[model samples]
Structure formats: structure tokens, C-alpha cells
Target chain A: AQRVTQPEKLLSVFKGAPVELKCNYSYSGSPELFWYVQYSRQRLQLLLRHISRESIKGFTADLNKGETSFHLKKPFAQEEDSAMYYCALSYSGGGADGLTFGKGTHLIIQP
Target chain B: DAGVTQSPTHLIKTRGQHVTLRCSPISGHKSVSWYQQVLGQGPQFIFQYYEKEERGRGNFPDRFSARQFPNYSSELNVNALLLGDSALYLCASSFGTASYEQYFGPGTRLTVT
Candidate 1:
């Protein structure tokens, strides 16, 4: 079965400090990876996808197939960057085989 | 264009009761997927519908059912609901299967007591 894992339940980082939200997925072959974010009182939204290879909100994630991971990284954490981050894996199939999401990590940027 | 939308932003029901949730996909989107998100957990896949047909289903019980319409709208029905059903129900829409990424709605907060 396919699965996504986010080992950290909660992570605290001071402003301007580097931050990394760990994410690992279990899937066969090359898989699409994504990072979604949900701010307090806000709906979940797409932050970035590995296919695009583009950075959003200064956050970037590289799909490391060798490590079976796609960890979210940011050079300098900001107060506004604090939110719930989820790592998801998409399966290329028809039917209700939607994206498999991780348990999510609560990133708290301490001021 | 408007993003995906879901009705009944908040709902509260007692155990054993029934509840129905609705979702409208973004214009031009032919696929709609449903998920259940409990507090402090990621959303779990529930169902997927495309072109008014059931494409995929998750590891849910028969009590959980859903259908899509010709207009790309969808409804999720939960019969004999249980307390564990309390969670946020999110609806996502996409153009087609495969490489197309999904866009999500605000989600409906369902609370079963």
C-alpha cells in the first residue's frame, strides 16, 4: 500500500532560523510529491509540487527518490511561515486514488 | 474562476443520525474527490467521482456513500453516523486523473456527538 509519513508532530524554530519539515513517502517507482499548508483559521492550500521544481513562499522541497523523502526546507523562518505542513504523494491511477497525505507537522515559528 | 466549493460549512449531529455533505467542483473540472480529516491528522481519501461515475473508493464502510452529478457537483452521505465521524470533510477538484494536481475547498466541519 502507498503511504506518506511525517515523523515530527510539532517543530519549533526561531525567526530567521533555518527550518526543515521532514516528509517521507512509500510508493513504487517515481512518484509525484507535494507540500500543502494550512495557516491558522485558513483552508489548506498547495504550497509547492516537486514536478514544478519551483519555490513558493521561500520554501522548496526536493524529491529524493534515493531517500524516499521530500523534506520541506526554508532558509529563514518567518512568523507568518508558522502553519501546519503536510507532505502528500499522488498516484497515477483512475478512481478515488487521490493524493496520500502525511499526518502533518505543526511548524511553530517562535518570535 | 471560482475555486472548489463545499456547502454546510459547519454541522453537528448526534450519533446514529445521518448527515449529507455537498461539493461543487471548479468550472471545467471533471473530477471530484472526498476526504475526511480528523483533528491533528491528515485527510483520508474517501471517494472519487468523474463524469458522473464512481471511479475510486477508499477503505470506508458501506455507510459512507457518495454520488456525482452531470454538472460535476457531488454529495457525500453518511448513514448511522458515529462519534468518530466528527472531523473536517474536504472536497477537491481536478481536470482529469493522472498528472493533474487537485485543488481543495474550504471544507465542512462535521461534529458528531
Candidate 2:
């Protein structure tokens, strides 16, 4: 079975500081990776996907097939960047099957 | 366009009772997926429906069932609710069965007492 692991339950960072949210997965084959974010009082939304290879809101995650990791990072964190981040994996490239999600990390950006 | 929408933003049910949650996908969307999110945990996949057919299902118990309507809306029925069933239920929708992007609804907070 595929499982996603996000080691950190909470991460606190100062404004403008670099941020990294660790994520690892256990999957037998290549899987599609994604980062989903949920802001306070807002619904969950997609932040980035590995296949796209494009940064969103200064956040980027690279899928490391060798290590089975897909860590989310940002060079400069803003106060508004604080949110709950979940790392998810989908066995099917197109997400037809469904996703296995990590417990999630609560990121707090202190001004 | 409106994102996915769920009904009865919140619900309270007694143990052993049955409850139904509704979801309406965004305009033109044809696939809907259901998830259960307990406090302090990420959402867990429950079921996925496309074109009114069950396309995917998670390891949830048989008490949990779902169906999609011809108009693309969906409903999740939970039977014999337990205290552990109290959580936020999120509904997501995409354009097709294979679409990678899914729009999420606000979610329904179900409390089983």
C-alpha cells in the first residue's frame, strides 16, 4: 500500500526566512505528487504538483524517486504563507484512483 | 465559477443513526470524490464517482456508501454512525475521471454523539 509521511506536525518560521516541509512516501512504482494547502477559514486548494514543475506562490516541491521524497520549499516565507500543508501521492498519473495524504504540517510564519 | 459546494455545512447525528451528506460539483464537472478528515489529520479518501458510477473507493467500511447523480452531483451516506465518525467531510470534483485538478468544497462538519 502507498503511504505518505510528513514528519513534522508543526513548523514555525520567521517572516522572510527559508521554509522547508519534509515529505516522504512509500510506493512501489512511480507516483504523482502534490502539495495541497488550506488557509484559515478557507477550503483546501492545490498548491503545486510535481509533474507541472512550476512554482506557485514561491513554493516548489521536487519529486525524488530515488529517495521517495517530495519536500516543499520556499526561499522567503511571508506571514500570509502560514497554512496547513499536506503532501499527497496518487498512483495513477492522472489521479483517477485517489490520493494518499500525509497527516499534514501546520506552518506558522511569525512576523 | 463557483467551486464545489456541500450542503448542511454542519450536522449532528446520534449513534447508530444514518446520515446523508450532499455535494454539488462545479459547473460542468463530472467527477466527485468524498473524503473524511478527522481533527489534526489530513483528509482520507472515501469514494469517487464519475458519470454516476463508482470509479474508486478507499478502505472504509461498508457502512459508507456514495452515489453520483446524472447531473453530476453526489451524496455520501453513512450508516450506524459512531463517535469516531465525527469529523469534517470534504467533497471534491474534477472535469473527468482522469483529471488531475480537483476543486474542494467547504466541507460538512458532522458530529456523532
Candidate 3:
């Protein structure tokens, strides 16, 4: 079974500081990875996907096949960046399947 | 365009009772998926539907069931609910199957007493 692991349950960073949310996955085949975020009282939304390779809201993640990791990164964290972040994976990468999600990390940006 | 939407934003039910949650996908989306999010935990996959047909399902018990409509909307029904069933139920929609990025709904909070 494919499983996503997000080691940190909470992460705190100062404004303008760099932030990295760790995410590692265990899947046998090529998998599609994504980062989803939920703001306070807001619905969950997609932050970015590895296949796109494009940054959203100054956040970027690179899929490392060798290490089976897809860590989210931002050079400068902003106070508004505080939210819950989830790392999700789709094992088949092709079929209409549900994503397996990590427990999520609560990101707190202190001003 | 509207994102995925769920109805009955919040609900409370007693144990052994049944409940139904509804979801409407984005205007052009054809695939819908359901998930359960417990407190302090990640969302767990429940079911996936595309083109009014069942495509995939997660490791859930038979008490959990869902169906897609011809219009692409979907409904999740849980039978004989337990206290453990209390959680936030999420609905996601996409243009295609798992190959496409899924858009999530605001989620319906269900509490089983």
C-alpha cells in the first residue's frame, strides 16, 4: 500500500524566514504527489503538484525519486502563510483514484 | 466557476442512525471523490466516481456507500453510524480520473452521538 509520511505535526517560522515542510512517500510505482492547504475556517485547496513543476504562492516542491520525498519549500515565510499543509499521493497516477494523505503539518508563521 | 460544494454544512446524529451527505462538483468536472477527516488526522479516501460510474474505493466498511448522478453530483450514505463516524466529510471534483488535479469542497461536519 502507498502511504504518505509528514514527520512534523507542527512547524513554526518567523516572517521572512525560510520554511520547509517535510514529506516522504512509500509507493512501488510512479506516483503523483501534491500539496494541499487549508486556511483557518477555509476549505482545503490545492497548493501545487509535482508534475506541474510550477511554484504557487512562492511555494515549490521537487519530487525526489531516489529518496521518495517531495518536500514543500518557501524562501520567505509570510504571516499569512500559516495554515495546515497536507502531502498527498496517488499511487496509480492514471486512474480515477482517491489520494492518500499525510497527517498534515500545522504551519505557524510568527510575525 | 464555482468550486466543489457540499450541503448541510453541519449535522448531528445519534448512534445506529443513518445520514446522507451531498456534493456538487464544479461546472465542468465529471469526477467526484469522498473522504473522511477525523480530528487531528489527515483525510482518508472513501470512494471515487466518474461519469456516473464507480471508479475506485478505499478501505472503508460496507456501511459506507456512495453513488454518482447523471449530472455528476454525488451523495454519500452511511448506515448504522457509530461514535467513531464523527468527522468532517469532504467532497472533491476533477475534470477526469485520478490523472487530473482534484478540487475540494468546504466539507460537511458530521457528529454522531
Candidate 4:
């Protein structure tokens, strides 16, 4: 079974400081990973996907196949960036395809 | 154009009762997926429908069911709801079944009493 793990339940960092949201996955085949963010009382929104390799909101995530990790990183965090982050793995099996998500990590960027 | 829309922003029901939640995918999007988010937890995929057919279903039991309409809109129905079923139900839409990037709608918060 494929699974995504986000070890940190909450991470607090000062504004303008670097931020890294850790994510690791367990899958045997080629994997597609993504990071999704949810603002307070808002729906989850896709932040970035490893396939795109495009940066969004100054955040980037590189999928390391060796480490089986796709950690989200930003050089300088902003107050508005505070939100809940989830790591997702795309799973395709037996005609059933869906995303398996981590428990989620709450990020707090303090000014 | 409007984004994905979910009806009844909030709902309350009792144990053993049944409830239905509706969602309309963004225009031109043929795929709709349902997720359940427990308090303080990430959303769990429940069902995915494309072109009026069931494409995917999660580990949820048979008490949960869903269907897609010709217009691409979808509805999730829960039978014999339990208190543990309380959570925010989110609807996600993608251009196709293979489209990995999904757009999510403001979830309908279901509180089972």
C-alpha cells in the first residue's frame, strides 16, 4: 500500500526565515508527488507538483526518488504563508486512481 | 466562471440518519472527486467520478455512495451515518481522470450528532 507521511504536526518559523515542510512516501513504482495548502477556513489548493517543476508562491518541491521524499521549501516565509500543508501521492491501481495524502502539518509563520 | 461549488455549506444530522451532499464541478471539468476531512486531519479521498462513471473509490465502506450527473455535477450520499462520520466533505474537480492537479471547492461541513 502507498502511504505519505508528514512527521511534523506543527512547524513555527519567524517571518523572512527559511521554511521546509517535510514529506516522505512509500511506493514501489514511479511516483507522482504534490503539495497542497489550506488557508484558514478555506479549501485545499494545489501548491506544486513534482511533474510541473514550476515554482508557485516562492515555494518549490523536488522529488528525491532515492530518499522517497518531496519536501516543500521556501527561502523566506511570510506571515500570509501560514497554513496547513499536506503531501499527496498519486496512486493508480486496478482502474482506481486517487491521491493518498499525509496527515498534514500546520505551519505558523510568525511576524 | 464559477469554481467548483458544494451545496449546503454546513449540515447537521443524527446517528443512523442519512444525508446527501451535492457538488457541481467547474464547467468543462468532467471529473469530480469527493474527500472527507476530519477535524485537524487531512482530507481522505472517498470517491471519484468521471463522465458519469465511477472511476475510483477509497477504503470507505458501502454506507457511503456517490454518483455523477450528465452535466458533471455529483452527489455524495451517506447511509446510517455515525458520529465518526462528522467532517468537512470536499469536492475536487479535474479536467480528466488523469489530470493530477485538482481544484477543490469550499467543503460542506457535516456534523453528525
When summed lDDT is taken over every stretch of 10 residues in candidate 3 chain A, the lowest stretch is A90-99
Itemize residue pairs with steric clashes in candidate 2.
Answer: none
- For candidate 2 chain B, which ten residues in a row score worst on lDDT? B95-104
Error of 3 at A69 (Å): 0.9
Candidate 4 lDDT, A1-111, residue by residue in tens: 999999999999999999999999999998788899999987789888898899999999999999999999999999999999999988673134778899999999998
List the candidate numbers ranked by lDDT, top first. 3, 2, 4, 1
Worst ten-residue run, lDDT, model 1 chain A? A90-99
Candidate 3 lDDT over residue span B1-113, tens digit each? 76888999999999999999999999989999999999999999999999999899999999999999999999999999999999999999989986347888999999999
Cα displacement (angstroms), candidate 1, residue B97, comes to 2.5
Q: How is the predicted docking of candidate 4 categorized under the CAPRI scheme?
A: medium
Error of 1 at B67 (Å): 0.8
Backbone clash total, candidate 1: 3
**Prediction 4 global C-alpha lDDT:** 0.91
* lDDT tens digits, residue span A21-74, model 1: 999999896678889999998778889989889989999999899999999999
Ten-residue region with minimum lDDT total, candidate 2 chain A: A91-100
Judge candidate 1 at residue A27 and give its lDDT: 87
Per-candidate DockQ values are 0.59, 0.71, 0.74, 0.54
Task: Provide backbone clash counts, one per model.
Answer: 3, 0, 2, 0
Alpha-carbon shift of residue B17 in model 3 (angstroms)? 0.7
TM-score of each: 0.93, 0.98, 0.97, 0.96
